[model samples]
Target: MQIPRWPIATEREKELIDEVLASPHWGGFHEIVARFEAQFAAAHGCRFGISAANGTLTLELALLAAGIGPGDEVIVPAISFISTATAVSRVGAIPVFVDIEPYTFNMNPSRVQEAVSAKTRAVMPVHFGGPLVDMDRIADVAARRGLIVIEDAAHAHGSQWQGRPAGSFGLLSSFSFQNGKVMTAGEGGIVLTNDEALAAKMRSIANQGRRPDATHFHHFTLGTNFRITALQAAVLVAQLERLPAQIETRTANACKLLRLLEGVDGIRWQQVHPKINRNSWYLMLGRVEGGAGRDEFCRRLREAGVPCSPYYPHTLYQNPLYRSSPCRVTPCPNAEATIADAFWIPHNVLLGAGGLMEEVAEAVRRAILRG
Candidate 1:
């Protein structure tokens, strides 16, 4: 009835995919993959880029290359997708989950100081909903403390803050080209970094650590198979060329909804960074000021043919994974508070994105009035 979730690829995407299928070499590990890597490096203002199987593995590879391993602790936002912390854990390191900014949903840079210890190795911040996490502040903290900043930029593509690109601030940045992202290769991702050594190490880790120029199956480091296919690369190359228009359209639709939802009594869209001229707008967040029926409000909007929904209806710390994890024995007050109140509505990429959002906002207004 309404626009489906995201990235309803255009005819341009269709044509390009067809061409890719017709080609003999369509894997991400092929020569064209290098082209895409080079393009992504240039786009992110990085010296080198390396493609990996998916967003999670790309992040893990980056952490490994950065020399984050056993006995190390990487501080992460408690409000983000689990992948952020899981990547840290996969390399035998502990994930020190810190609370997020109530408004930004990005890691609180100030909190990292409290979380840091002798074993603290890095800070991994997520760019929640496409706005750059106060990266300059994060970078300053990391530099002063001699810790690496690994950006889980899976939500941010082409997002910038104060003229510096989102991908440039971290020692290493991982971007997802997952189906729902702004720039997707369906199931592929990349790690970007200005450091040449880190970049090469990432490359080797993604490809089983085969030493360069020696094809005798020589292994340099213990690594895994996290390389993407040629087909995925072809899809990404095509998708990259069409991103500008798609981003403009999604931004326009998000603003339209923001205008309709603001001042609607209890509900409010999440705050944007003052430096953000553009909210790449991965999702449109709305927090209920004091509604007795926040969850039901969302349910009614969905039942009214609007298809809006809540994201992270409960906090991660409430889940079995974190509640029993050895890392945290105490409750994260900020994470619990934010997750209990914060929720999201859909931001579709279809031509009907604007109208769908307007209808959903109207539905929400009615539901709240009656709640």
Candidate 2:
């Protein structure tokens, strides 16, 4: 059972790249980059999109655009990639870490209320592994608390909740085109928003703080270069075209695998929310009974030719960098439990044929049996 290679490039990608290489403007000011930005934003149901250097910088740009600076705080999940919290810190604000849901491994909205402080300016919910955070609950909390919602939608390109797209739910949502993400451009990111003023601000900030129409070398605000080049955009445009089909395939394979694992003991799959109409299926997540058994289980699965690994072994607060950082931390039993038990199968494996999913399920069953 051979798995498909990731970041799959076809003739369309080559054609776009050739166009960019032949064009005079291969920089951020090219039409190719602008086109990709528009296409991605439209697909996610957003009014404006601003391209950036990478996902991390896009989060920082969103924070800065929202006026989140010193003396402010942002609520984030304890179980996300470090960038979710670090982006808040990069903008001179503190990140208040909250717990996540044990089953979904997403920010626990019930914990958001307790994490809110007088200094809290926004709530940045990450859609971990392509399953959306409970946006409806997160929105209600933010509204009552008067906090902005900035979605770290790095793992949620096509994910939707209650028929609404992931990038459209927040004041500003960020997406990554990193190599590991469902969509890839080698390295790139984009910010999506409906607010025209906020869009302009992020656009300017990403392009060295100059007005979009400015012809001269005049800096309007304190900003640095965090621009995406035409080359990356060219690849991303082709990738975006291929995304819908890929998402369908991944979802089908995920459903098949889940069905096959139904009677398997000691394994619990990530529970999808009732409201989630679509999941991007970036990774198929699950957990075993014991933390001690998790590693050996993964080792066994890999030996059986199923690509698997433990998901974030530690919560963000457990990192050494957080110890000296100016951030607030609350008890996160769910996050801790998730770190101990959860493992993941990469999205690329799901891109394989339906028969491959059967092999994956058999591998899981064997791993559990041996343990």
Which candidate tops lDDT?
2
User: Candidate 1 — which residues are off by over 4 angstroms?
Assistant: 1-5, 329-331, 349-357
Estimate the TM-score of every prediction: 0.92, 0.98
Clashing residue pairs in candidate 2 are: none
Give per-residue CA lDDT, model 1, range 106-158, as digits (tens). Answer: 77888887788899989998999888888778878898888999999998777
All models, RMSD in angstroms = 2.2, 0.9
In model 2, state the lDDT of residue 66: 94
lDDT of 2 by residue, 137-196 (tens): 998999999999999999999999998999999999999888999999889899999999
Judge candidate 1 at residue 285 and give its lDDT. 74
The whole-model C-alpha lDDT of candidate 1 against the native structure comes to 0.76
True-structure lDDT of candidate 2: 0.91
| TM-score of candidate 2 relative to the true fold | 0.98
